[model samples]
Target: MTSKRVLVAYGTEHAATAGIAEQIGVTLHEDGLDAVVLPAVVLPADDVDDVRSYDGVVLGGALYAGHWRRKAKRCAERNADHLKHRPVWLFSSGPVDSSAEQHDIPPVRAVAQQMESLAAREHVTFGGSITSHTPGLIAKALVRHGKGGDFRNPERIQTWAHHISAELAALN
Candidate 1:
């Protein structure tokens, strides 16, 4: 089988989002796709970069308050032209509690809306993992307000990755 390269770009806080991105990348690879995980902050500043080389792109961000992190939004905005022409998937990871339901899905944020205009397939909201070990005083405070614990589910992440792989394969 020919290798299909996928870019897993992320905007993260407290490293939780990064871990999720990495797991997605690994899952993609397991499903026979080549995936690279890059932080949104570390991506090249130029809007017109070489991201077109990838067959697909997955952009994930840590949601704070209601919107994605600023860096994540900037990444999408900067690369809007390229992303608009490609298969893109978006995810927002947050919500500290296990009881969260449909309300956990972020309201249509601007960045997500922009991608959606380009035919992005999905915008998933994954439960976040927060603990006392989360860094920074603000993180701690948020954890208290969020009643944080490990709410992330590995199976859900794996299923999402598999679905993405299946969709891409059908396109191919």
Candidate 2:
């Protein structure tokens, strides 16, 4: 069988969202699927051409003040027609906290309704990285970010990967 092509795109200000997208692509690769994780800012034009090139697309990004990254959202809106017709999934890497088990429902999550409400097969919230842990994101000259390490749950990521894999399999 021909390997399936999946585009996992994310828009992030500091790279936390990009980290999550990369992990998803790794998981999909483990399942022997053709997956490419593209940062929304650097995604190639072919990434949004049509549904024919990819079996599925995963839209992911960070939420700030209750909204997905603007560029990521626009990418979705532009491809709304294809997303509505194909297997689409959305995930947000936000809700900052120190514990992986803590599922803090940030009030800002409501702003992501557009992606969830617009015919996506499913959506999930992820524990985001702490600014304390990600030092390189800000500035390295004057002072180190002073901290590093994401609080996001690896277990939850694996579980979501399993779910997406199953759903994509079902489609094939």
Candidate 3:
């Protein structure tokens, strides 16, 4: 099988999002695609192929204080000219506690909407949250607000990755 290039880029404050992005890259590779993971912050300077050059691109960002890190959204938005012409997917590793957070999906809708307007092939939520051990400036503050739980589910992640792989295959 010939490999189709896929870029899985992400931004994270507590590293959770990066882990998920890496998992997706691995999943893609196992499915016979050439996948790479990169930090969204490093994109503007990296020699990596531009968004338009990939067979598919998946962008993920962690949600903090009701927002996906602005840098991730901006990275995707700034590449709209290229992204709009290629298969793209957007994910927000969001939801501290679906039962608690006022907004279930977080504010990634704005970024998702932009992708939709650009005709992204698909969009999904790989739901994530602050675990008890997650510690940092922002994560610490999140805990202060009563956010603590392992909301991540491996099954869900795998299913999403499978769907993305299928979508890209159909595109080709």
Candidate 4:
């Protein structure tokens, strides 16, 4: 059997989202799949290789003001045709607390809706992190409003990654 390759693409502002994408890629690799982690802004031109080159895709973005970063949105839109035919999963990282999990709702519905046409296997909302060193005035303001700190759960993230690996393995 041929090996499967998965693309773990993400958009991040402060780099936290990039870390998540990298971790997912590592998990996928350890599970016997080839995974590449790349920023949405540089997802390799569809004309060069196309999203069809990958067996599956994991797309994620950092949420701000109840919306995903534009680069992530654009990446999906640019590759919608080929992506629609592959196994896709979506994740959004946001929320100063674990409220997204408790409420069972995405931090940004519009962001989730963007994947409606792709028939994604799952859409997850993970807790986000903010630090005193967060960049930008708006981030500073949000931090001042008690939205700062590390709320992301590494164990939760790993569990989700394992789930993806298992699902892909089953498909293979």
The lowest-lDDT stretch of 10 consecutive residues in candidate 4 is 39-48
TM-scores of the candidates are 0.85, 0.76, 0.79, 0.86
**Candidates 1 and 3: which is better by TM-score?**
1
Best candidate according to lDDT: 4
Q: Which of 2 and 4 is ahead in TM-score?
A: 4
lDDT of 1 by residue, 69-150 (tens): 7666777777778888889898878777764344546435675575666678788888887789998887798678867787
Model 1 ranges off by over 4 Å = 37-49, 99-107, 142-146
Q: Where does candidate 4 stray beyond 4 Å?
A: 37-49, 101-103
Error of 2 at 42 (Å): 9.7
Q: By lDDT, is 2 or 4 better?
A: 4
lDDT by residue for model 2 (1-87), tens: 667778887777678887787778778777867775332322422245555567888877687656777767777777777777778
- Candidate 3 deviant stretches above 4 angstroms: 37-49, 98-107, 141-146
Q: Candidates ranked by lDDT, best first?
A: 4, 1, 3, 2
What value does the lDDT take at residue 54 in candidate 1? Answer: 78
Writing each residue's lDDT as its tens digit, candidate 3 over 28-133 gives: 7777777853323223212234576577788777777567776677777677788887887777776766542233442355766766766866666666768657
Pull out the clashing pairs in model 1: none
* Model 3 lowest lDDT segment of ten: 38-47
In order, candidate lDDTs are 0.75, 0.67, 0.69, 0.76
Question: Candidate 2, which ten residues in sequence have the lowest lDDT sum?
Answer: 37-46
The CA lDDT at 51 in model 3 is: 73
